[model samples]
Target: MSQTESTALADVSALRADLDLVDAEIRALVGRRRELSREIQRIRQASGGTRTDLTREMRVISPYTEAYGRQGTAIAMALLEICRGTGAPPR
Candidate 1:
């Protein structure tokens, strides 16, 4: 390959490495969110509260919506699903 092509390939590899680090960070944060969500679910059940909190969810989604526009809402909703599970009614 030409020197220019080799240099471009190296840059792409470096960027991919950065993306891998970012992916790891995101996975760690998602696991932490899941743990926190489980704790909240436990407390809510103990206190006779419902599992779903629309108000709190909207609050959680608000900043993302503001920062990223429509895509932010989508990302927030996906994160919510990851942390809280689908909105399936309790058995």
Candidate 2:
């Protein structure tokens, strides 16, 4: 019932609101990534080939991961797993 306690609760609520927004954005981006993977699969199928291209995955993920100071290849590998789970063609 203290003012300090109420202030802390308000701050927590604000942080949760921000986090919810971020979660929505993350979900949207993931959906877009899945859509792109489907398009990639279609493109490969039309070219009479199968299997996702690892190099293409690397190319797409590298810059994004690099900005996070992480290994791009590792990020690509993780995405490959996610893509497979979503029914995208395997690399």
Candidate 3:
């Protein structure tokens, strides 16, 4: 094999390794978020408040959109669906 071809293969392998590491970190963060959601559910139960809060949802989503440069509205709506199913309000 040519030297350049071997170098390219090594570079690709390194990128794959980095991606795998990032994937694992993403999974961990997602799990943590789920736990926080559960805690929120418990708090709302204690307070006798609805599960969803549209205002709170917007607030929670804005920063993520700003930081990540994605569609905050869509993500918030999807989460709202989950919250609704859990007896949370749109707001």
Candidate 4:
């Protein structure tokens, strides 16, 4: 390949590696969030409260929505689904 083509390929490879690293970090963070959410769910259930609270969830979704617009809202909802009580996480 020409030098320019090789350089572009190298840049793309580097960017893809960076994206892989980011994906791993996101997975770890989501796992941590899931653990924390489940703990909160346990505590709340023990205290006779509901496991999921919509008001608090709205608060959690707001910043994500602000950052990603509609996409953020969808992302936040997906996170919530995966982190809640027996399923995924929470707010």
lDDT per prediction?
0.89, 0.75, 0.73, 0.91
Instruction: Work out the TM-score per prediction.
Output: 0.89, 0.70, 0.70, 0.92
lDDT of 1: 0.89
Off by over 4 Å in 4: 85-91
Give candidate 3's error at residue 68 in angstroms: 4.3
Residue-by-residue lDDT tens digits, candidate 1, 1-91? 9999999999999999999999999988888997899789889989999877989999999999999999999999988987786656334
Task: Give the per-residue lDDT digits (tens) of candidate 3, residues 1-91.
Answer: 9999999999999999999999999767655766687678779978998765668878877876887667766666655555445545334
In candidate 1, position 51 carries an lDDT of 77
Candidate 2 worst ten-residue window by lDDT: 82-91
lDDT (Cα, tens digit) per residue for candidate 4, span 6-90: 9999999999999999999999999899889989999999999999989999999999999999999999998888888455333
Which of the two, 3 or 4, has more lDDT? 4
RMSD (Å) per prediction: 3.6, 4.2, 5.4, 3.3
Cα error, residue 24 of model 2, in Å, equals 1.4
